[model samples]
Target: MKTVVICAGGPIDELAPLEPYKLSDEVVFIGADKGSVYLLNEGIIPTVAVGDFDSLSSEEFLDLTNRVASVKVASVDKNETDTDLALIHSLDFDPQQVVLVGVTGGRLDHFISVLNSVYRFQKDNPGIQFIVRNKWNEMRLLTPGIIKLTTNPQLPFMSFFAFHENVEEITLTGMKYNVSNETINIGSSRFTSNQLLDEHGSISFSSGICLLIRSSDQ
Candidate 1:
């Protein structure tokens, strides 16, 4: 499957752990105003650099234009956020999966907006997979089906949260905490946190939507 990486302007420290997985050709750097600096430091030339660039000096903006293949400048007055513009551009590539890096670990509003965008994309295209990755966590949305989780062996905590309605008929296997045919609804906080018992675990639900958050404190 074709994969595309969207690099937004956020805390670079949170993304350091992900360096090993970075591939030059598959990345699309979204400047998000000041994010262009981070991309340049990593030696990544963005396919498309976007945002109103209000945070950048004229020199920096000129540097960004010289480095990237295409620079999409928007007005700071636009309705959609910089990240939103980045996502929209990524979709144009018809990628099988989109992985967002440097998207979290900063302002709560931006993080929440990015989360909402993930759900919005899922609603628009049910089959495509979208994931947000930071130093500590990997978040993905699930519709209705079985989700198998094998312990990373490196990072061992797995958690689930309901994004839409509660997830119904949820079942868990091979975990320290187990749940069977239970409903995980908003305000329930039933499945906020769980641990992996064996090397692997599986989750299945009959209906509803949820976000499977696999994380490690390290």
Candidate 2:
């Protein structure tokens, strides 16, 4: 498939354009536990639902089962969280890109755990593109390679950080704070909050991983 969107049961203030995806037959939607109810409330039916679903009430769970054709319920005592299981299920469709929504702005513990899962997924599946986005921010995990991005109207500000030790030969072009072959280490805030200078921007590195963030002020 071209794209798959996974909606988790996290707090979502606003969601980006889903009408287009809803109309198109190529896009797949997977709901993680209570996210199924969230999807239905938004007028989009999930193709598949997967989770332990401890968050849902008995009535809600029955309604969900009745609404969605496919439901994979898990044991509440499982190792992975509902979001993680939902993510793994999404891979069955083998989408070119996976956009994660409603996966942020919840419990701090759940947020951090989901972030770690996303990072691990990126590392394991370097060929596929993964994006985590909400109303205010968009995030991507970058492995060693060059990535070019165009200006985003909603999220104009950009930031880059080393995900591992010694992100070597880092270079940035077409940005406010352009760099050339500089190295940055984990926990360093040297490349934070850089804005785009023009229509396009690029980042490249020889080794290590990076977390690229596109965000806007609320």
Give the per-residue lDDT of model 2 (tens digit) for 124-190: 9897788888888999988998998799878989988887566899999999999999988988999
lDDT of each: 0.80, 0.87
Off by over 4 Å in 2: 14-17
Query: How much lDDT does candidate 1 score?
Result: 0.80
The numbered model that scores best in lDDT is 2
Candidate 1: list runs displaced more than 4 Å.
16-18, 24-31
Clashes of 2: 0
Q: List the residue pairs that clash in candidate 1.
A: none
RMSD of 2: 1.4
Q: Give the best candidate by TM-score.
A: 2
